[model samples]
Target: MVKTKIAVLVSGGGTNLQALLDAQREGVLTDGEIVLVISSNDSAYALTRAAQAGVPAVVCSRKALGSQAAFEAAISQALSDHGVELLVLAGFMSILSADFTSRWPRRILNVHPSLIPAFCGKGFYGLKVHQAALDYGVKVTGATVHFVNEVPDGGEILLQKAVEIQPGDTPETLQRRVMEQAEWKLLPQATQMISEEIRREKDQ
Candidate 1:
C-alpha cells in the first residue's frame, strides 16, 4: 500500500508532532508518513524536532509574510510541492483562512486540547483552554481530534478521550496529563484511520 504523505503544521514546542513521530517510528502510523513539518514561527522547536527525526522542515513565518493570503499561498505551495496528501495541525497557532481550508477540504485535521463546543473556538488555544476548563471547575476535560473546516475548532469530530479532572489538578498538571493520555494516543490513531480511508478510496 502506498503511504499517505502527511505534513504537520506547528508553531510551538510540538509535543503532538513528537507523538506522531514516535508513533511512526513504532509502526503505529502504518498507512501514513510524515513527509514535512512546517512552522509559522521561524524559531519553533518543532523544526528542531523534525530535523532530529530526519523529516523536512520549513519555516513560513506569518509575520514575515504580512498577509494571510500570502502566508496561506506559501503554505499551499509547500504542500503541493511536497505532494502532501494529508495536513495535520499539530500545534499550529495561526488560523487558516477560508480559502486555504476550502482548497484542502477535509484533507486537513486538527487536535484540540479540549472537547469541542466547550473551551474551543476563537481565543482558546494552548494553555488557555486548560485554564478555562480548570476555572470552570469541570470534572472532566480532555482532547479532541477532528476534521479542519473554515471555522476555528468547528469541525466534524473524529475522536475524543475524556480525562478525569483531579481535585488538586492545576492547569499545568492537567495539561500534561491530557497530552499524555489523550492527545498522544488519539492523534496517531485518528491519523492512521484517515490514512487508511484515503488508501481505500484510492484503491477503489
Candidate 2:
C-alpha cells in the first residue's frame, strides 16, 4: 500500500505532533506518513521536535511575506515541494488565508481545544478556551477535530471527545487534562480518521 504523506502545521510546544510521531512508530496511524512539519513561528518548539524526528521542518513568517496571501503562497510552495498529501493543524495560531483553505478543503484538518460550535469561533484559542469553559461553568468540555474551511474553526465535524469538568477544576487543571487527552487519543484518532477516509476514497 502507498503511504499517505502528511504535513503538520504547528506554533507551540507540539505535544500533538509528538503524539502523531508516537502513533506512527507504534503502528497505529498506519495509513499515513509524516513527510514534513511547518511552523509559523521560527522559534516554535514544534520545529525542534520535527528536526529530532528526522523530518523536514520549515519556519515561514507571514510578517516577512507582507500579506496573508503571500505567506500562504510560500506555504503552498513548501507543501508541494514536500509532496504533502494532507495537512494537519495541531496548534497553528494564525488564521489561514481563504485561498489556502480553499485549496486544501477537506485535505486540511484541525484539532480545537473545545467541543467546537460551543467554545470555538473567533478569538478563541489556547488558555482563552480553557478560561471560557471554566467561566461558563459548563459541566463538560472536550476537544474537536474537524476539516479545515475558509473560516477559522468553522469546519465540518469529524470527531469530538468530551472531558468532564469537576467541581473544583480550575482553568489550569482543565487545560492540563484536555492536553493530556489530546496527546493520548484525540490527535492520533483524528489523523487516523483522515488517513482512513483518504484510503477509502482511493479504494473506491
Best by lDDT: 1
What is the C-alpha lDDT profile of model 2 across 50-104, one tens digit per residue?
A: 9899999988788878888888988989999998989999889989877778888
Estimate every model's Cα lDDT from 0 to 1: 0.93, 0.87
Q: Tens-digit lDDT track for model 1 on 1-204?
A: 798999999999989999999999999999999999999999888889999999998889878999898899899889989999999999899999887888877789999999887899999998899999999988999999999988999989999999989988888999999999999999999999998888888889
lDDT score for candidate 2 against the true structure: 0.87
TM-score of 1: 0.98
Stretches > 4 Å off in candidate 2: none
Top candidate when judged by TM-score against the true structure: 1
TM-score: model 2 vs. ground truth? 0.95
Indicate the residue-level lDDT of 93 in model 2: 91
Clashing pairs in 2: none
Candidate 1's C-alpha lDDT?
Answer: 0.93
The stretch of ten residues in a row with the least summed lDDT in candidate 2 is 179-188
